[model samples]
Target chain A: MLPEALDAYVAAAREVGNPSSLHASGRHARRVVEEARERVAAALGCRPSEVVFTGGGTESDNLAVKGIFWARKSTSLSRTGVVVSAVEHHAVLEAADWLGKHEGAQVTTLPVNAAGKVDPARLGAVLEAYGEEIGVVSVQWANNEVGTVQPIAELAALANRYGVPFHTDAVQAAGQVPVDFAASGVAALTVTGHKLGGPIGVGALLLGRDVAATPLLHGGGHERDVRSGTVDTPGVAAFAVAVEITIKTQQEYAARVAALRDDLVKRVLSVVPDALYNGDPVDRLPGNAHFSFPGCEGDALLMLLDANGVGSSTGSACSAGIAQPSHVLLAMGADDDRARSSLRFTLGHTSTAADVDALIDALPAAVERSRRATAWKTPR
Target chain B: MSGGVDSAVAAARAHEAGHDVTGVHLALARNPQTFRTGARGCCTLEDSRDARRAADVIGIPFYVWDMADQFHDSVVDDFVAEYAAGRTPNPCLRCNEKIKFTAVLDRAVALGFDAVVTGHHARLGADGRLRRSVDNGKDQSYVLAVLTRAQLDRAVFPLGDSTKAQVREEAAVRGLAVADKPDSHDICFIADGDTKGFLAKRLGATPGDVVDARTGERVGTHEGAYAYTVGQRKGLDLRVPAADGRPRYVLSITPKTNTVTVGPREDLLVDEVTASKAIWHGAATPIECDVQLRAHGEVVPAVVTVEGGTLRARLLTPARGVAAGQAIVAYQRDAAGGDAVLGSATITAAARTSVAPEAARA
Candidate 1:
């Protein structure tokens, strides 16, 4: 967390008040929440009325998927199909899966191209063939693992043409890219707090006023009767400061991190000549440097690097410590071995060139030993 | 870890001993069965869940390391191939040799862990020599003898001093959910205890003649020679009794001709056993010791010697039912360290005692 966000959070955490209550203290809390909402709306190029505060990014995504699909059901039960990109986060994908399992929602995961982009032509074709049946279409603004940025404006325009509600989980893109909810023309945009130098447990779902979405929660009818439960007044305050600072400095932050990331890639490639850079080389998140080491398993490499005091992540590790091959890499025509070998190095605000120096110093030997360790398989 | 009370309590004890312990359960099988017939079989979904629950209760970080590839190649496939060669392989020993002590332990060390800890009922002395567990009923040193000196040095077995009952009591005290979980038995791959059926499915059935080894008289037919193990009396389904009117047992299975040889109990007595793929710890020597043919089988007196990585054993007392492809684990029988495992090998052949005069009827 940034020192500014930490200070704001600490200062606000001392106060005790509920925004839903009608007392004088509650009025002050309500004022703070509204101010935070206005700041978030201004930063993201949306209206204050459109920002629906929820617990976090996952809850916001779940509400957009399940709630929108349920609302569409009331108008036309025939519209039960949910269209989502194959590279969506588990938050959106699992929510869609739950709808398919029990809520009578048919899901169609549109495939992606070699760049991890949902092919616009494929989405257009699906919209033409089953536009009337597709209750909602969702594609992430930026993939978390491989850092491939999606062409959100083009996809959202197509969804709008077919009159289907479109949602974008911009949790990874909000503070790093120029994310204007109105400009992208998505019916709903998902953004979170902790990912943007704010406290956890506070986020917003920017729902267009004309768009129709049912409520996922039912108590107190908070946030324009969409998301209920006591509003996190302190988290909202901390989140507003974070969003304000991140958006104001996004361009400069991107330039600095991208330079460091490029340095990291150059140094690492010098050490590991056969390492394959993943995702789109030209158009990717500025802070992400993902690579696939040919002879190394991502888990082994992660452990070796972690032992050397460098923290990194594989494509997707479950709670069981099982490293599943990246679906994004597979969608991009990578074989199972290449997909399994992927490692993501995400540079955040706290990242520095010294960290890159440390990673480069240990990466060559780490990869060499990691490959040799698993290579001693006695012949069957 | 086996996800049993022993491992859970062992992990708790290690943590209590001020060692920075991490609980790792080996995911040794792909597509673990969601429901197992017996109590908490290995690599089942229930076992993984139970392990995670125990870790949670113990307040330690828990992870399930995927060892399915290594296990399938080393233990499971090796088991099928060994049976195909007419040997009764002990998959538990193979797992202990390949999966636990070698692959999992090496990976743990590479990942900055000092030692690999498990729930096996064996003691590792301060001098790093492997010893029998305090409870002989639960002694696992025979299977663990295949571990090298370096592996034993970096391994910790906290349940060595405690009996199975004490381990369960410690698990209850630690609030582990698997305290009362029943111990798993038999081949883990053969969950239903139907090794013949499982092998028939994988290796396919080949009809073979079951003949009397003494008189060469045809007894019955079997679906597959790979389905029978030496000294097995049950499932023979012989039509005629032995010439001496005594029960017969399987003496040999020849995969080449798909033949199973059965005979009277006297033919099953063996005085010599030879083994290959011998692995020795400490020193290789011609030593008089006790050889255990199977896990928890009888510890018969023998002179076990290793010559050029092959084991040649002369049983001081005649032993019965010795089968090829079973592990012949040599143990020290001296009073100083009773039944301490010396080394082991996979028996390739055995020399039977001379046929008894009373059983030589045509």
Candidate 2:
């Protein structure tokens, strides 16, 4: 049934038409693209004109950052500064770093608390210091690995006071949290397809009509000339469907997943009493549980769990091969050893109570084995 | 667990003993370059998976322990610092003393396990004394000397009584995955066996000179004196030929002088060496034993003495090029046959002879 929905995607994928072209087939493709934009915008509480399709979350982030920066700086070269939260995904952080490193733009990364959420007051202070020079300010809607939900509304309001354009990578938050684009009042926002059961190659940047953004990909002008390329009609349609399904079922989904996540935490802590939960206890993502077992190595525990027919990531799956301690945990003031000993368990729409139960059943022995295999100097 | 034939047989023997046994491989490599390309180290991820498969065939569980951080701090960093201070560090010794015996053993005890087992070719005598493995060619008593009594109480070496050939035959009979896995040599961290490159990366490239001690003339320019050890002779960029035209050996590394003292090969021998940080496996005090300096070096008779945390051993026969920071492991012959570990220490300094000629042949 899921593949059938993707079959419709495949049929639409075969036809190539520039949505910006004014010809008959182009108009038909344009209508399909517009319909997808409308469906997605309605689901997220935004207008159809506000939706601009991009390659994926990464390209969306790059376009939003570089575009916003260029637009702001073109108006006033003095406005060449960007402020971002320290816990942002590498897309934003790396892009900002590139600007700072080569583009003569000064980037200030705001520090986060132990819970991995940036203080709005700190953002306000930073804005006050360099408000006139600030080109763009970004903070993630929800942390990808730790599941810390940032107060995006509060951050947006603070940015508004300084007249600095704010952008949020709502990639991890789109279906998991309450993301109302119209209510948030942010100049730009980023959302990807994969995290919410959409096609992998599709995503959109929600740009406020008044906001100015330079085009990242240039060819035939498309998506209000903000992002230029032939649109993936099938991908965009499937993404719209996924977003609509996710948003409609979010409340019930969140409740069920949160309960399951809570049960996992309770069972795990019951077995390993000294397990340290990383991220905010209550204000975290519904299906994300990050924990640190003091003497047990995370990779060791992960392998043990895999041996027991359960699979979980040792922190971020993106940095899978690098055995170094997580940069995110290190930024949160965790020691190198503790950072290396942490694991991340993320649940999606496919997760079930039975899955949680299986994990809980196998966790005790796995933790015991891993702890024995890689002991530390301390007893815990 | 599966890297060498010994560990493979050890896992089998432990299972045959009716204990619920599981094999664990520690992943300590930070990069692919740090991995043992030809099956030399026991800590690679691939080796861990192989161990897991071997355990599966034996109807037991297996796991890979991520010990990258601890290995970096305890072994790699310590090695760099030791060499920077003009001492030759043994990383395998540090790893055995810290990670395998100490950290892993402690965790095994806490997990309600009676013992942690390994394939190290060393034994425990009938009186529960640490002994040399029956396989004389594979005896690892020197490295095992740092294990404390409490650690040995929960330690089991299954290959202690077996020869290397017997271990391979046993593994082949049992059809284990890594029965043919080659023994790892060189420092595990130095994948390409480039100790110079490893040290240069750790301690920055500070160029120095290797000079003749008697002539005070520069014999060769070196990347750093720290890169050259006590007995190294080749790869010194020497331009001038000695009067005898013999190749010069690095007699000493003077980090304070930023100079490598070079002389003829005979100058490398030393009759006395002092070691500290002694750890006795079964006994509380020092005892007379044969001491082995290098891993494959010949055991020489020595009278061991200890006072206030310092241990000094005077060799009955003059030893060669005994470098500081290397382990001097004491081994005694047990009554039941096989040698027992007395203890070990890090050599802090060696006595230099006042007579230059005598020093050259000491």
Candidate 3:
């Protein structure tokens, strides 16, 4: 977290009073929350009333999906279709799946190209073919795994033409990229605090004023009846500070990290010549560099790198902590071998050239060992 | 570590002794997500959690190395193949030879680790000779005898000097939660301890006849001849009783004809054992040694001869129920010190003395 945001959060956490109370202490707490909401709105270019505070990006996404789908289904039973991209995070993907299983919704999953971007033309075609039946269209602003930045404005425009609500989980894009909820043409956008240097468990859903949605949590009738519960005053205060600062310095952070990421990628490719750099070459997140090392198991590679003082992550981890091949890579037209051999190295504000060099120094040995430790199929 | 008291204490001891210990639990189960009802299995979801928790308490990095595919291909597949060929295969010994010693150890060495430390109840002398543990009842040298000399060089066994009780006490002292965890028994992959049912699932039930060896008559029927092992007295469910009215035991299984032969317990006795593909720790020669025929089974005094890559041992005293497909691990007996492991081989055949005309069979 940013030091300023952390200080604000710590200071607010010590303060007493529920924002819903009618006493003077309650009024003070209410002012803090309201002020934080306005700051969040101003930074994201959304109306203050549109900022509905949530627990985090996942909660915001769940609310925007399940809440809006339920609300739409209640009015027009025929419009029970949910359109989502193939590379969405499990939060949105699983939410759509749950709706399909329990709510009798028809889900249309649009596939991505080799670069992991959802083609806007596919969205237009789907909407034209099944416009009236579709209730919501959701595609992430940026994929968390491969770091593919989607053409959200075009897709949102296509959904708007069909009179369908568009929601984008901008959790990965909110602070790293320029994300204006009002300008993006999305009806609802999800953003969280942790991604932007704020404390975790605090986020917002930027909902359009006229967009109707049912509440997932019911009681206290907070956030214009979209979200409810006693407000997290400290978390919001810190979130507001983080949002304001991250946006103000997004350009500089991106430029610096992009250089570091590029250097790291070039050096890594040189060391491991057969390594395939995944995702978009130019349109990916500046700090994201993903690779697939053909004979190396991603789990072994990640652990070896971690042992060498370089921390990275594989595509996904099941409940048992077994690393399954990345679904993102699989959606990008890669085979199971490629998906199982991929790793994502994410650079953040604290990353440095020394860190990248450290990874470079560690890559060759880690790759060689991981290749030797290949998937249990070596001929005896 | 195996998520048991012994392994947890082993890791703790290694770390305390100034070694850079990193705890690794082998994720050998093909599907750890399967909901298991009992604690009779290893590498289950519960075992993984216990291992991770123990690592956390010990203040070391922990990882679950997924050896499921390797284990399935080597140990599990070999187990089914051996059974189909009418042999009672010990999967634990196969695992020690193939998965742990070969696969995991090779990976560890490549990853810059000095040694792979385990919690097996076996000792390695200062001169690097493999020996039995102080805890005789829990000694695991028989299974570990399958490891090659090179693999043994990079292996560390920390719980050899202590008994099971001592390890449990150390775990309790160290506040490891698995201190009271029940010891895993039976085949781990067979969750319910139903070996026949497990084999039947893979090698589907092939109906066969059970014949009485002495009378040379069909006595009963079986779903699969692979399910019965030599010397198995229970579950025979024999339809015809012997003339002496004694309980019958399985004598042999012939997979080609899908026939299981049964006889009186006296016929199960064998004074000579022959094993193939012998592995000797150092020098291979004729020696007077004790041979353990199966895991946790009795060790018998025998004169062992190795020739043409085959081991032939003549037992001084006859051992009942000696079966093929089990290992015959040779040991040099040392009463005051733990017995040294000479080497091992897979039992291929066993026979009684030819002088005993009525009982002898090959």
Using TM-score as the measure, which candidate wins? 3
Error of 3 at B205 (Å): 2.6
Per-chain TM-score (chain B), model 2: 0.92
Backbone collision count in every prediction?
Answer: 0, 1, 0
Tell me the spans in candidate 3 whose CA falls farther than 4 Å from its real position: B35-38, B354-362
Ordered from best to worst DockQ, the candidate numbers read 3, 1, 2
- The top-ranked prediction according to lDDT is 3
DockQ for candidate 1, C-alpha atoms = 0.26
Name every residue pair that clashes in candidate 1: none
What are the candidates' interface root-mean-square deviations? 3.3, 5.4, 2.2
**lDDT score, candidate 2, position B154:** 77
For model 3, state the Cα shift of residue B115 in Å: 2.4
Which prediction has more favorable lDDT, 2 or 3? 3
Name the docking class for model 2. Answer: incorrect
Where model 2 places Cα greater than 4 Å from the true spot, the runs are A1-35, A47-49, A110-132, A145-163, A217-234, A259-284, A288-348, A352-375, A378-380, B1-87, B104-293, B296-362
Q: Write the per-residue lDDT of candidate 1 for residues A1-380, one digit (tens) a residue.
A: 66788887777778777888899888988998999999999999999999999989999999999999999989998999999999999999999999999999999999988878788999999999998788999899999988999999999999999999999999999888889999999999999999999988889999999888899999888898998888888888899999999999999999999999999999999999999888878778899999999978887788678767898988786544467898789888899888988799999888999999999998988898777756534343
Residue A52 in candidate 3 has what lDDT? 96
lDDT of 2 by residue, A1-380 (tens): 24534765776778877676799878887887888899899999889999998888999999888899989999998999989888888899999999898888999999988888899999999998998799999999999878999989999999998899999999999889889998998989999988777888789999999999888788877679888777888889788878888888899999989988998888888888999999988778899999988977787777667766787876553221345577678778888889878888888778888888888888888877777666454433
